[model samples]
Target: MAKGYIEFDYEFCKGCELCIQACPVNTLVLTTKMNKKGYRLVEDAEGKCTGCASCALVCPDAVITVYRQKKAS
Candidate 1:
């Protein structure tokens, strides 16, 4: 199995929840934190991101970056 995580460009996020909905692992959630633009933030609740890039692909603001651990040969 692959392991991965996501980083959010917090300031650019509009709290649209698109990334949350696009996440296949259901690890994404809304947080109490707010961006400079006053939009609520999303977080990887369980650290279970699969680096699928689904979230990033769906983000209208392009705020998400997914990073995966390289598999050992």
Candidate 2:
């Protein structure tokens, strides 16, 4: 299972690739498909996301929400 996952608000997102660049785990990428606004959507690539919030921090549109699983102690 992935350590974390991100949810994107495609309608609010501007399709900026800043989130993709900000992801330390390289979990995000810009897809060819467009959102309702006709902007290319950012999607999660196949990878392990560490839930660092880097993508959320860099997003100007505040479109990304991250969910992380708690590690077993």
Candidate 3:
């Protein structure tokens, strides 16, 4: 089960593939399709991110946004 979700701003993403390479957990992947700007944007591997936010920190384009899971009530 997923603990959180990550959003990728394809508009701002330069498609440099830095996020893909920087992911320690191998959570990021480069899709075959390009973004609106015709750039290959980075995508998060579903159910893979540990909420470590490594991709968010290393993103040069600052397009990765990680939302962590909320605490139990």
How many pairs of residues collide in each model? 0, 0, 0
lDDT (tens digit, per residue) of candidate 1 on 1-73: 6999899999999999988888888999999999898999999989998899999999999999989999898
Q: Model 2, range 1-73, lDDT digits (tens) per residue?
A: 5488888888998887999898887878788989888999988877578778899999999998988888788
Q: Quick one: best TM-score, which candidate?
A: 1
Candidate 3 local lDDT, 18-43, one digit each (tens): 77787777867778878778988677
Off by over 4 Å in 3: none
Comparing 1 and 2 on TM-score, the stronger one:
1
In lDDT terms, how accurate is model 1?
0.92
TM-score of predicted model 3?
Answer: 0.80
* Poorly placed runs, candidate 2 (over 4 Å): none
lDDT of each: 0.92, 0.85, 0.77
Colliding residue pairs in candidate 1: none
Model 1 segments more than 4 A misplaced: none
Better of 1 and 3 by TM-score: 1
Please report the candidate that would top lDDT against the real structure. 1
